[model samples]
Every structure is written in C-alpha cells, then in structure tokens.
Target: MFKHFYGDNITEDMAMKFRNAAVALNVQISPAQVQGYLLLRKEDPQASIDDIATITYCK
Candidate 1:
C-alpha cells in the first residue's frame, strides 16, 4: 500500500516507528489513517515522514 508512493523504502522499521508513535498517542493505524497520510503527504511535500506519521495518528 504505502510502497506505491515510497517505493520499497516503507519497511517494517518504518512501520514500527509509526506504530510506536501512534501507540504513544493512544491511537491506532488503520486504512483511514494511511489514506489520509497519503493525501496529506501530497499536499505537504516538504513534511518529513515523522511529521506525516504524527499527523496521521493525530487525525
């Protein structure tokens, strides 16, 4: 799914990072979050992966 935009770079480590961050915020990652992140990434190209992930869980 995320490989579509990030190529082959979206590995377990990255997912883990996102998951950890989400967990810390008492949030969960779901399809809706991924889709929203993709859209937000498109709208904010300058945002880092961490920033995007943070926003995803926040939403």
Candidate 2:
C-alpha cells in the first residue's frame, strides 16, 4: 500500500512520483489511475498499474 509505505499524508508531488514510477515501469496509466491503484494497493499490493493496463487494453 502506497499510503502505508509512503504514509496517509501523501502530497501531490508524492503522488506524481508514484505515477512516474509506474510510467518508468512501462505501465500505461494516468496519474488518477495511479492514485487509484495506490489506494487499492492498501487493500491488495498484487493489484497494480500493470493490472490496470491489462484491464484497460482488454476493454
């Protein structure tokens, strides 16, 4: 979980860093999507930007 790893008081800059990490990982995800993934990761770390890309491409 990003919030857990990074903390709940995450800032916009921190969110951008996380999004950039996903992008650097070659995962095609928007900042908002990355934020969503971070929140979701709080519940499931296995849930990732790659999974989001897979679902997006499938759609």
Candidate 3:
C-alpha cells in the first residue's frame, strides 16, 4: 500500500518528518506505525501529515 506511493525508498528523513508531524498532532506513534500514516497520506495527498495523524491516531 505505502509502496504504491513511495516505492521502495522510504527514507529516514521521511520517517522523521512523519514522526514529527505525529508528535505535533499528539499521536502516540512508533517507527513501525509510520507506514500506516503514509497509507493515509496516499489516500489524501491534500492533507497535512499532522491532519492525517490526528484523524487516524488521535481519534
């Protein structure tokens, strides 16, 4: 799913940004959970990572 959008190039920088966004959104996320966020990002590219994290995790 995530690979459909990012291919096989998930970078540390990308993970870090997602983590930071999750943090700002007050979502308790681990490194492994980032793929789920990325999946949500793929579904709604117009959404900020913070918004995705909030809607998916902070519910």
Q: Pick the candidate with the highest TM-score.
A: 1
RMSD of 1: 4.1
Q: lDDT by residue for model 3 over 1-59, one digit each (tens)?
A: 33345655665555566446656767456545555556656654335344654545622
lDDT of 1 by residue, 12-59 (tens): 666566555556766557777766776767543334356754664535
* lDDT, candidate 3, at 23: 64
* Model 3 pairs whose backbones collide: none
TM-score of each: 0.48, 0.35, 0.39
Which regions of candidate 3 fall more than 4 Å away from where they truly are? 1-7, 28-54, 57-59
How many residue pairs clash in model 1? 0
lDDT of 2 at 55: 31
Model 2: pairs clashing at backbone N, Cα or C within 3 Å? none
**Higher-scoring candidate on TM-score, 1 or 3:** 1
- In angstroms, the error of model 1 at 28 is 6.3
Give the residue spans of candidate 1 off by over 4 A. 1-7, 27-30, 42-49, 52-59
